[model samples]
Target: MGCCVSTSSRSTCSTRSHGGAVSPSCFEVGFCGQKRTKRTFSDHVIALQHLPSVPNRIFTNGKSRTSCIFTQQGRKGINQDAMIVWEDFMSEDVTFCGVFDGHGPHGHLVARKVRDALPLKLLSSMHSYQSRQNGSGRTCFRGNSKKSDGGDSEKDGSAEDRLNSIWKEAFMKSYKAMDKELRSHPNLDCFCSGSTAVTIVKQGSNLFMGYIGDSRAIMGSKDSNDSMVAIQLTVDLKPDLPREAERIKRCKGRVFALQDEPEVPRVWLPFDDAPGLAMARAFGDFCLKEYGVISIPEFSHRILTERDQFIVLASDGVWDVLSNEEVVEIVSSAPTRSSAAGILVDSAAREWKLKYPTSKMDDCAVVCLFLDGKMDSESDYEEQGFSSATLQSNHSGNAVESDDGQKSEPSLQRNFTVRSSEESDSYGRLPPEFEGNADTVAAEDQNWLGLEGVTRVNSLVQLPRFSEERPNP
Candidate 1:
């Protein structure tokens, strides 16, 4: 017998799954009157599979308040962006947030798939790191420990090295697993579809960011003179960059800008230009996988201080119309925490109408995380003339100190390429022969960011198989 569950006070009911989960398509009439289409519901289910089981705590945290707003591109069939904002993501003190921008036919599905699964996979990798270290009692990183002139090698090197090594391994493996999961999903079609991801996991004051493609993470802070400033956190992985174009060309892919949009360089097939991808790295786009597009993410860290006010994560829609400084201004001047994202989206939508009257507006989604509970007005930020010396001094160098007083470099800016089959597992682990050589690692060689193995792709050129639960989110 099937069970019926009540979602709220309204007279609506949804079927409960006994073992297998119920399809997300079945929505009660009046309760969910504004019903989502079949495709959209499917995408939501795919995303919900990996969401943390914690109760809804949206707009609840006093110190670290969070809010989100997603608006469809004017008259576009559906919004292709997906976002996740978890206040107590893994633990009470940890908060997790992500923004995904999808493109191509099945881009929405691809974005939802990553939104639901990436975080869970990352947590599993974290567990694996702990397990490996517990069994071995040694660090996994390779390279000569770069020492500071007056710093103690013993105290500074031991703990920070172990943690950094653990995080690097976890990030690489989790991302690899996410891509593998997408490629293996039977119902979903990803041959020409892909998504860009920008995620942040904040524990205490430490911020760990994992980013791919062009969606961005930026911080709004008070400078030395107490003037609000915008600090870009992730590099925009657009095909226009020299390094990105070079890599794409090396892999036999073509990079060029369309006549109308000369500023936006895109990656295309050497022989065909049907699917010109605008980003250099992404989770799917299997058609271009062999042609230079990859799933590896750039990693960075930041130690938040009193001057840091808030952080913003948004899709290109917001970035396209609003400057980083403008976004900071809008968010800072908002009346309350719950309304900041909506205000930003509304502002962008207006700009889209005014600037590109003939073009379809891109979907806009924004996530604002307020570090300090106070919401200051624009005038308050622009009092100006205050010396930004202290704020500048704090971030002058990329190095950040953890709560425990150990200093670690916040940005790990390395180029990630597709791996070969002999390289690593789906979790990006090195094939047994490459383990246990921390002393021999060469700092100059940027290729070995994860475990010892290389990247690989399946050669079967066909539609993906369909299963109710194969990819396992």
Candidate 2:
């Protein structure tokens, strides 16, 4: 007999197997079997509550028949990283890929929200821009480009250049609209939470990219001597960058490194030292928007060549422990095209444990897009092993001593804590949540800042007060 369960709002039931498990026939295999059938009443309710209004064509799992994508949760808490790969995105030959790394209390939700909504926004903007061009009967880029002197000069550039211009405009519009929507979201509290995005669109031989934050993208190509070489495609938008730091300081936001972790620079408010965000650009984080933190993505274009093999988009988790050369070598040596991303992620996880035995691992996400439609033979490079020299110079900055006098680097998984006015006396004491065995804490409440198991110092040196508003005695 079928079992029935009822709640205050509704009722549900289904045939159960002899072992009390959900019937296998009722399950629908999602892309790469990434999604499983709901087995309980609460699971079904949660799925129904979060269903998207519009269907998505993007694949989030590495097991997809069409593309490669994978993500692993860290020891700290729920995975705050997300990724997507969409084939035939806007046209028969175009493709879209992105990776996001989230931070703060609601970071995981923010990352997934951007993964589902950002691509749709880009598609809509592209359609609207095309409509405007069709009506005006002009080939200019929204009146931003200089007018040609005469003749066919306006259409003289190569096809690649024209494609880049159109995509650049679409990316700008979509990113701005996405950030605006996040700010007004009724269910999300984005005052201190945010995410970083590294996205790319490949139309035929041209590749256009728009990104914000520390997540990165890189390309692997064969050199004249048949050796695979790594080419970094995006610059990490950290607060330490000269231009990024200047803008924040101009808006009265303070930028500096803590005495304990001197290698990592962070951005803080003028009156309070809370929310020491490491990245200079990100979605949400409404608190810092007024202090020069912007969502405008840095854009770039690359024309693919016969030598280019594949492109990898990943969050800082992967980049933190692995260098560009090491990542490229690992992907190139994968046993099969479908297993490339998974192998790389597993390798990173192993490295985290080996390098920082005492620190909690960070969430890792990766997307591997092959260009030649086939996997190359394994190279003759030595077995997977990390050199001490490479670890000291990973992308963000050089290595520094931790509070316990151990070597460490700035991790993208750093924590963001906001203290209330009444909690000033408990500044140096560890929160009760982290008092016992660290691994025993709930995933949602795990702290990313104290990964090395060290006590945190209060970031705020002095509190601000208003003198003129005092009551007359």
Candidate 3:
């Protein structure tokens, strides 16, 4: 059963909620139409729900079964936490792509915030892109699954450079905007809430990447024989990497496990907890702010290819289980983009489910894109022989179905909007968050200063963000 827990300080939208701390008049809770609480102002800190937090468990051979809490009510959980195969995302302009992974709770809500935020950010960024393009007369361009490197044929003009400038604006602006939107929502406090984001912006022949988290981006191309090859263009925010591990220890953050692991091998969450979240680097997680969360910027504009066969975008749900090569194989063999996403999620989710029956099934979110084989060829859309052109998808259900054909437990998920020709939304709403949680604060704030070797790219320009036109704020 799914339950939603929210403490609305004000009553406006009517959605079910529970286990929240709200004032007698402004707050209310209802389960299946039964009013559990009524007329109360919400407390500053409250659990959207009182769901159990068991150890992250996954059954062997099960796919990505990350634990998730769904309010199962109305829009209350619409964005609360969920995952979908995103079977179809047909587009005419630069393929729209994104990856949003939430933490500290089910990813559905964070994902929703991201889904809403990205389009807004992109729309907001259009003004910036347009201004830059108008001023310089540069060519325009643009995911996770979107290739980082297009063929040399695609990498022609100032498109890559302009793309970088625009996206930088989008991410920084959206981060702040998201904070504001969440705060103003009916029931939500400044709880360390947020999600990791990685997206792509493509135009004409150019491709750009925008990211702020550990989620990765890759490019793949197939040979005439129909075999796919992939290349990774993103690096992880590993806290225990040789260089990073030492920095955490120096800053007084726990670099190793608390279970008496060896010093050199020991590691803890960049903020708190153990088991899974050890990333010294990631986005969102208001709790990690004190540790210089805002200081960490995204890595952008690695590369894109026309020879690029396909692109893959996924939450850690996919990475948590499949190897890079394994992921490539699944996507390469899949009949369609939607099938690719479903196959990947279904496989990953089951692994987690079987391994962690006592734990929450990791919700899997995948957005995959395949090249228009006919685009490279002089064939018309009709000649491309797209069996499902008018249809939004060409997915194969069994790609993710069980042996018995029974569907897995319903996880949280939501629809997303794609922004094109530059989305020009406004900016600056969220205050850079503070207040690290007890379990993770010490590590997150660990100030391992004066690290050698690794150079911090504070103001580096990459695709999707940054441009010479706008003055740095």
Candidate 4:
């Protein structure tokens, strides 16, 4: 038996499955406007009757039978981190998980939007590919053959190779579609704002991962000595990487770090020092797309083993301060499976204060999916009367301390708009000194400081119009 609540009408409907019955038995909990029909096992509940397109399982900031998710706002203006765990995603044996980190003025919205839509796009692409394969009378996991020296050809490679190829193509198509959608969204301005996504799909014993930006995914596996070890699963796509920097610079995008913070390199416009994006690839930030910034995700595949204990997906906030080993240790030491994500987030918050007292804490989000099932057993610490409520209250997005160190009620929703003055003559226009001096500006090291929400200066610089006749680098 289960209950469904309708938010629009503030009503509840109880459903029970009868033995050997083919349908649900529904009972209305309250008096509704419609007359109650005779109760029958075959009749569907009015409250439960809804669109077939609705997602059946979507978990955020909560715990499921095999996973836990949590996010905490930082000292920044708003939390720009989002996460999800969708079980039974494409089939009974498949699951999807992702973590997104948004940056710039409207980052929170972009992150949330991607979290809710990217999976659906990927699913659609996968189905389309399968349909085409079926129509062609070929298996989806088979690729074209390559001619050999003897003029004889064979299948491209092994089954695993073909599977990887299929998923990589799906990821690329979905990512491209997602970015295109963001660019044309009427209500969203993605010229100077964007989000990072690190997603993974688990099908049976295999894992397919795709990601952009600094957010990361890792697995915790048990060693021969029964010690838990952390294995990083994705590369952090920062602008400082050699390949990334070379591409950006070749396309006329400037890549450099401010003198004060040489460790963090950023991508800027060719002629203007603005919108210092820290990542090499991301969704949105169209102004930089022509200059080598892409939404293409790096893809990888791994087969799960008996020793694999769990997987952790987190924003850079957690990775900034917590090492992979530290994160694995923290999650392993958690009092209970349901408390793992909250505890990991809380630990990151404390680390931020200790490591960067002067800098604002970045938003943190985490998703923990346990594999072995044995980890869900109650720990001895929980037996000592551990209070799960206290842990959740402290880390969950609820009444908490604001950036100013004051107690305040958390706003359920925040509204932001680009000011009319900001959109006037000053908007998307280069300053006098920057005009026709692209060479000089590109030669000099830019001193743009800090990422959005990291330092006093805002990294979300206004866009600048590009000259059509500008020479290539």
lDDT (C-alpha, whole model) for all candidates? 0.56, 0.61, 0.39, 0.63
Which regions of candidate 2 fall more than 4 Å away from where they truly are? 1-56, 63-66, 137-159, 374-473
- Check candidate 2 and list the clashing pairs: none
Q: TM-score for every candidate vs. truth?
A: 0.65, 0.67, 0.51, 0.69
Measured on C-alpha atoms, candidate 1 has an lDDT of: 0.56
lDDT of 4 by residue, 1-473 (tens): 11222211211222111112111111111222235543321233212123122343333455654677888887766777788876555443456789988876677778877876787677657656655665676532211122234423334345556677778898899888889889988987777778899999775556789898778787888879998877767766767666788889999899887776555567888877766777789998888999989999887777666787889998877876676778889999987877789899999889877766787777789999887533343343245344465334322323232234533332122111111222223212222333454432321121111222333323343446564655554
The numbered model that scores best in TM-score is 4
| Candidate 1 displacement at residue 116 in angstroms | 0.5
Off by over 4 Å in 3: 1-92, 129-163, 179-186, 223-227, 241-255, 260-277, 281-283, 295-297, 350-360, 373-473
Q: What overall lDDT, based on C-alpha atoms, would model 2 receive against the true structure?
A: 0.61
Scored by lDDT, the top model is 4
**Better model by TM-score: candidate 2 vs candidate 4:** 4
Superposition TM-score, candidate 1 onto the true structure: 0.65
lDDT of 3 by residue, 160-211 (tens): 4544565566656755665555546565332344466666644323355566
Better of 1 and 3 by TM-score: 1
